[model samples]
Target: MNIWTFDQEKDLNTTGAGLIAALLQSKPKAVLGLATGSSPVGIYNELIDMYRRGLVSFANASSFNLDEYVGLPVDHSESYRSFMNEKLFKHVDIKLENTHVPDGNAPDPDAECAHYEQLVNDHGPVDIQLLGIGHNGHIGFNEPGANLTGGTHVVDLKEETLKANARFFPSFDDVPKQAMTMGVASILKAKQILLVARGEDKAEIIRTALRGPITTECPASLLQCHPNVIVLLDRGAGRFM
Candidate 1:
């Protein structure tokens, strides 16, 4: 994996935006795998700025999000769907029909997972996938464990992940215990993977995933095995390295 360390969050975001612009320039119909969380917020903002400036256009591109809470309604403020609409989709020219986020409220969640995976396979392996590592090194929602799912599936959230994500909810109890996420194998299958991290809070996990041993105990460490993985970190997140 290649590492790109930036001095500040804005710089990191700019670098990410430039990468996306290059991708769009080369393949306008690129299938983008997106991540939802604070780490990616600045990157999405940078992309929006590019869209407004006519330097980037997602008009022909399609997107699939990495994961979503399994039980929340789509309208829930903390739901990934709401997060994407507020942070990225609303400001871009991407087609609504081409956007996909797992339905957290689906009555038959197992079937939902299968269909989501099939949809991604139909249009993928994704041209580019953006990821955020959990404090425990989980990618998407594939938390640290001996057995990680190999396809899209529902996963119980790790405590560290719940705590990390609690910033989006009112209380720890309000956070859903489960999430629907693309599996580790699925994420690694993307043609290109970009993992972004910011803040000192992520330092330990970033260091472990990048410089430490590879193991399912720190799920993101598995990225070390991928041929086209790029890890971008701000100074704070790279401190441990």
Candidate 2:
């Protein structure tokens, strides 16, 4: 595990974007495992700037998002699909047909999960997987629990997760109660993992998940088992380190 702390937001964003850009420069066909939420927005913005400046190109890269709210329409503003389009995909040269986000509204969600997992398997060993740690130390939507699923599956959102996401919806009740997420095993298949976190609110959990024991209770703790993991944190999130 390689941990890096940044004093300024731009530094963190540039470093994160630089890592991805370097990967694309070496392997234009690299498979990217993407994430949504506030943690990665700055990195996405930096990447957008890089693309505009001809410093990087996602033209041949394919991407698979880590998770999606279970019942949200793809067109929904908060849907991971829309979030990716608004944040990164549409801004870069990546082909829309080569990007994948689980179909949250699939009639047979179980089948969708299986299909999604197979799709990932077919196109990856993702070269690099981007992740944002949830308040409960959840990775993707693989929430804290006694046992963690090992493939793409549907999950019941935990109270903390629901509350955290409630801010995005008009009302608490508007947030989706379920989600489809890549499992720990699926995520571990990635050749490299880039975990990002920011803000003082994430400090404690970041310390626990990275420095504590490897346990199912804190899903992100499992990243400790991976051989190649890079953690990027702002001063606030890295306070305890």
| Model 1 Cα lDDT, one tens digit per residue, 1-241 | 7888988778899999889889998999999999998888999999999999989999999999999998898988889999999999989999888999999889998899999999999999899999998888889999898888989999998887888778778889999999999999889889999999988989988988988899999999899899998889999898877
The CA lDDT of each predicted structure is 0.91, 0.97
lDDT of 2 at 164: 98
Off by over 4 Å in 2: none
Task: Please give the lDDT score for candidate 2.
Answer: 0.97
Q: Please name the candidate that would achieve the greatest lDDT relative to the true structure.
A: 2
- The per-residue C-alpha lDDT of model 1 at residue 81 equals 92
Models 1 onward score TM values of 0.97, 0.99
Q: How much is the lDDT of residue 141 in candidate 2?
A: 97
- Model 1 worst lDDT window (10 residues): 159-168
lDDT tens string, model 2, 43-115?
9999999999999999999999999998898999999999999999999999999999999999999999999
